[model samples]
Target: MTVGFVAFHYPRPEDFDDFVARVHQIAGVLRSVPGCLSADCWITTDGDDAVVSTGQWESDAAFAASFAAVAAADVDVTFDERERRPRQIIKLASR
Candidate 1:
């Protein structure tokens, strides 16, 4: 029963690099947490301001544990997002 989250994000034009950097930093932190299977970040070749991140876990319990770990580590995951179309989140479950 693995679970995951995929997020679509848009950075302010001038904030793209900084936003992506923060995404990578957070992903790195999550990867070290127990039960985190994979954490990845990506940017589109045709889109300069778009960033995508995915976090996968071993199970629902693992997902919860990872969130707790992230909170305990005091990792700031927020970014300067685009005003018009901020961030979108999607939850996933393994079939």
Candidate 2:
């Protein structure tokens, strides 16, 4: 089974560009991690302050290990004092 993680963030109105640029920078790093199958960053079309990033891993263990690295790097971002939620993990299944 492929393990996945979703991270949600809310950016400040004035920091929208900064938020997107930072996400792209992080995505590049995420793609280089070992056992990482794929990674993507997305924004909603409604012009909301929210963004979601998804990462696919080879296994649950691989996902957890990559998160440890992210945590050690203090990768969490806060915009307009909005709270950043914890990463959610899920198992991906094909149709």
Candidate 3:
């Protein structure tokens, strides 16, 4: 199995809740894609404007294919231009 993660940092705390909802919505879209075992959203406990999304896929190809499809769809949800980062992570030490 392959694990993927995306970390998002909001430029403005006011948009944090909305961003979390959007991330969850993205996870919902991925749930229907083939080989996507699961997707989840997480937030920090210290009330920081950060969110992380984790996804489990059968393989790297599956992950790439699904992401391509989403990109092709041209979904409109977006965050502030000043957002800190959208870090893409691959394979984070599975137990």
Candidate number with greatest TM-score? 1
Give the lDDT of residue 28 in candidate 1.
Answer: 82
Worst 10 residues of 3 by lDDT: 86-95
lDDT of 3 by residue, 1-95 (tens): 57565555454566667777777877777776898888888887777656777778777777777677667664645654645655445454244
Poorly placed runs, candidate 2 (over 4 Å): 74-95
Residues 1-95, candidate 2, lDDT per residue (tens digit)? 77786776666666667777777766666666788788888887876656777788887776777766665664544434532443343455333
Each prediction's Cα RMSD? 1.9, 3.5, 2.8
Residue-wise lDDT of candidate 1 within 1-95, one digit each (tens)?
A: 89999998887777778778878878887888889999999987885557899999999988888777777776667544442376898999999
> What residue pairs are clashing in model 2?
none
Poorly placed runs, candidate 3 (over 4 Å):
77-79, 82-95
Model 3, position 65, has a per-residue lDDT of: 70
Pick the lDDT winner.
Answer: 1
lDDT of 3: 0.68
Q: Where does candidate 1 have its weakest 10-residue lDDT segment?
A: 75-84
